[model samples]
Target chain A: MKLFSLEYGLFLLSVFYIFYLLPHRHQWKLLLAASLGFYMITVPLYVVVPFTICMVSYVAGLLIENTGRNEWKKAIFIMSLMVNIGILIFFKYVDFLTKSFFMALGALQSHFFQGSAFIAAPSPFNILVPLGISYITFQGIGYTIEIYRGNHRAEKNMGLFFTYLMFFPKIYSGPIERAHHFLPQLHERKTLDYELVSDGLKLIVWGLFKKLIIAERLSKVIDIVFQNPDHYAGIPLIFASVIFLVQLYADFSGYTDIAIGSANVLGFKLTANFNFPLIARSTTELWRRWHISLSTWFFEYVYNPIAIAKREWNQWAVIYASLVTFLILGLWHGASWKFVVFGLLQGVVLSAEFLTKKFRKIISSKLPEVVNNCIGVMFTVLFFSFSLLFFKAGNFSDAAMMARHYFIFTGDESRIYSLFQAFKLSGVLKLTFLAGLLLAVEYLDRNFDLKKVISRQAVVLRWLIYYMVIFAILTFGKFQQEQFIYFKF
Target chain B: MTDADVLKQVNEIFIDVLDNESIVLKRETVAKDVEEWDSLTHIQLIVTVEKHFKIKFTAAEILKFRDVGHFCDEIIRKLGAS
Candidate 1:
């Protein structure tokens, strides 16, 4: 079920009522049941996939923890990793792998015996990849690794572990909560807090405004230009590409806000996934802010180990590790070359930033502080927005086509005219105004507690502001029930 | 060497690697306390500390340091063992 839908609202309402009615000790059981019900409702038969992986990791964790011999612990660790990773590969990458294999074979056959149909193209394996398999398996793998590393003890309670993996709020698209951080919270007794619930409700409304009013409306404009890249060029293509990045940020961060807000209402805290990534002054800072959980996951698990092992290579070690880590991170997004390119662009930019750190600092020192900040923000936004062309495109070639068409502007009124013709001028202005309002709110929110400020105001004034927000959402919010973009990952 | 001496030496390494002589590290200081000490610079710090102290750290050990105090404690323990 869609998190933004009425059905989910009803479901959450039922759970909220029953949840507080139960004793704190039994709260976990209700959460587990709710998670299982959510999974079954959403993906039906594929519920077994996460269950099987969770079972493997759970058993593997116990075995590794119990084993005294280092060799035995290592064996169990590798075996469990293989089982978890193997299942993920089969489910997520089978089609991509099969297609690549068939293409290679076709090329080989043509080279050997002249061009022909070459035994007919194999039908695509239209596999039903289980929802949240990437996230679920990664969490499981992270848990097992932590246990094996002795960083954390294996949870004896199977139910709690399962609940951690399948927790309804974050399972769909994750803040990929680590076992060490999350398991301890599950053990705590939580009482209802008015502040927590109030904050959560505010967050939910804010998330809805971002997703419906900003992201959904922006996606409509992006779709026209991106879906038919051949029909448009110049300013329109650039506008669509830049807006696609904003749309993605709104949609994904909106989903995260709702996920975190819902979990908070239940007295469970998930990690904050975004930190105003658009304002990041550099690529390195951007990664730190954007998809924080995923980037940190890769940094901790993937990058650190590789960097440490190859430390003898000095800065080159970091460069190599970063590239490999981002490549894998990209593949984690999708089993496609386009995602790989998207990831490589980030890695390359990050490496460039790293290499030129001293030089850039020197240059910034020479420039006025305002000029430096402006240049940094402009460069970061332009580079990141353009790179997302790879992410938004249907495939690799389309992305390349868009990139090429970005610079091919016709010096005519038609180019600007086509964009206006495609999207109404008044609608564009409204979205622009809304986007500007979002930025202003975010900037203010970053510096101060917006909620607290609003609360401290006079009752009438506070209610007026609240009603205005509610009215804006009610009037402008698109109730199209558009799926969050990150859900596909 | 005393823990104070170890902290002093580690402070020098941080200043040298990060290119900021004005950096001040306390026992409770964490990576977030220092603007330059990100994940990338973190490896550089580790490498520099290892080289300066002539000690090796396992991946887990490297990752386990919660703060500057823990880092200093590890160095002291390694020095005593050696």
Candidate 2:
């Protein structure tokens, strides 16, 4: 079931009521059932596959934890990793592999592949994507790693462990909650607090506004321009590129808000997945702010390990580590070559920043603070937008054509204006207002909670602002249900 | 190799590596405390510490050190508990 749908809302309400009303000792069972119910609602048949895998992994983790022999522990850990990754690769990469293999055979002109005889043979089975498989797979892997590393004690209770992995609120797009933060909460007795509920509702409302009013609206234009880049070149493409930045932020951050807010209502605080990424003046700063959870996850688990593997390699090793991590990150998004290029572009930009640090320090000292800040922000936005072409394009050729048009600036400006007009000025104005609203809210909430700030205002002012926000969302919000952008990952 | 001496040396290295002259190190000081003490420059700190202390730390030990105090203690202990 969709997280924001009415049916899902009713399901959540029922789960919440029963969750608290159940005996404290039996709460884990309730959560486990709710999680199974949640997954079953989406993928009824394939639901058992992940559940069974998780159960086996849970048992294996307990075996590893209880085993006295170091060799036995290592064996168990490897087995767990192999199983998790095997499932992930089979589902995510089999098609890519099969396609590549046939293409290779075609290039070689293999006799077996003649007339599409062997190569075009249908697969024995159709692969069905389990809902939220990537998320739960990562969670399971992290749990096994933590157990192997002795960072966390394995949960003896199978129900609690299963519930921890399949928490419905975070099963799709996630903050990628770590064992340290999430597992402890599963064991705690949750007490309902009015403030928590109010804050959570506010967050959920804000998330809906971001998704419905801002992201979905912007997506309409972005999808249009990106789908037919040749038809709308230059300024139109540029505008769409900029809108993409907004769309990405709103879509992913909106999902995170819903996830965190839902969990918060149950007294489990999921990690904050974003900061004010748009305010970042540099690529590095942008990484720090955007997708904070995934970035930190990669840093801790992937980058740090590669970096520390060879101390003698020093700064070069660090740079290479960053590059490799980002490359892996890009691959993690999808098996597409476009994602590979996108990841490499980001890695190149970040690596350049590192390599030029000394030169920048010498030159930057002469520039005024305002000039530097402006230059930094411009460079960041321009580079970010350029890289996103890969993300937006249908293929490498499409991305190249868009890039060419972007730099040539040879498209008809009048045509761009007409195209904008075709979209309706009212839609454009609504989008602009939504963007402005997000910026204003982010500006105010840069340091502290905007809702809390509003709550503390004069009663009349507070009510006015609240009503205005609600009215704007209800009136201007895009009502078409669009899947979150990150759900594809 | 006293705690004070280690702190002083680490502080100087932090200032030099980060190019922030007014850096002050405390027990709880972390990489985030310095502007330029990013992942790249972090290796510079470790290398500099190794040279100064005449010791080496395993990757696992390095990863486990939470803050400057732990790092300093580990370095000191690695250098034959001087």
Candidate 3:
């Protein structure tokens, strides 16, 4: 059952009713069952792995907590970490490893056969990736680590831990809640509040509008340009790159909104994920604002540990740590060379910024503030767009071709006009309308909730705005259910 | 040194590392309290503290200090040992 679908809407309604109707003692069971039911709808058998892992970890945590010996507690925690990471590695990286191994063998064989006049082709492996595995595994690992650190107590109840791991709203894409934030909230009694319901519904509607009208429609043009980069050049590629930035923002933040909104309806608060990333004045600021949950995850778990471990090695170690963290982040997206390069480019750029911080400060002081801000935003956007070539292209060669075409501008203007002509007038209108809507909403809600503002406005004005938004979505929204962009990760 | 004196020195380190003139240190204040108290600046603070106080913290001890109060306590413990 999809989170946005009518069936799932009904399911959530029933679950919410049952949850609030039930006593505090039994409320958790309903949520656990509902979460499992939601997961079962998508991946029935694969659900067992995460469910079992959650149970085992829960037991292990309690055991560690009860143990008197520090050494035994440490051992138990290490075992839990190893098991969780072992499961994640096996399920996520098996196909990548297999293909890599075959490729390496083929390379050696080809070199040998060049002298012997023989040929052999390595067959690729087909792997069925489990749904929501990345999110659940990460949450599990974070929980284990938090317990180990004595930052949080381990949950003795297996069911509660399971619910924590497989919370339906955040299962697909996440705000990646930390244990300390989410667990206690789950244990608390929630009352049915009318304001919460209304606010949640409004946020969900806004998220749907973002996904359907803005992201999906823009994606059509982005896919067209990226699919055949050789056909178009210069301005068209630039337009595509700009559209991609919008699409990524809409898709990711939209999903996060829905996740947070749904959690709010249940009286659970997930972490805020996006923070006006496009408005960022620097690549460093962009990272700080963009996919904040994941960025912070890398910061706390990956970057800090590595950087701290090698602190005596000085600034070079800091730079190296940042690069390694970003590279791992890119690899986390997919098992592709393109993602690796894309990540490395971001690392290199950000590291350059860190190295030149003093020089940048001197230059900024010399220039006008407005001019400096413009240059900073331009540099970040251009760098981001250039790296996105690796994300959009199928392989390294395709990425190179797109980059070359983007810069060289060798293709004819007639070709660009032809490509533009291929898109429907309605698609163009929809894109323009959605872009305007997104920008207006983002501008208004730059610092606070736009919905709250609307709610407090004159009733007639608020109703008119609401109806117009709903009408636009119904009339112009792309209805095809494209999987959220981050689901693959 | 007195706790207040230690804190005054710590406050100077925070001001120097964070590049902020008006940094007010509190018992409950952690790294996230200041805008510029990020991981890189954090190491610089630690290094500066080590040089100023002639004390070193183990990784485990560093990780355990949740706030300024805990950090102060650790610093005091190190100085007392010396």
Q: TM-score of every model?
A: 0.96, 0.93, 0.92
Residue A163, model 1: Cα distance from true site in angstroms: 1.2
Error of 3 at A185 (Å): 0.7
Residue B33, candidate 2: C-alpha displacement in angstroms: 2.2
lDDT of each: 0.88, 0.80, 0.80
Runs off by more than 4 Å, candidate 3: A108-123, A410-433, B18-29
| TM-score result, candidate 2 | 0.93
Q: TM-score: which is higher, 1 or 3?
A: 1
TM-score of 1: 0.96
Candidate 2: lDDT of A251? 82
Better of 1 and 3 by lDDT: 1
CAPRI band of model 2? medium
- TM per candidate, chain B: 0.97, 0.89, 0.94
**Which pairs clash in model 2?**
none
The reply for model 1, stretches above 4 Å from the true place, is: A108-121, A410-415
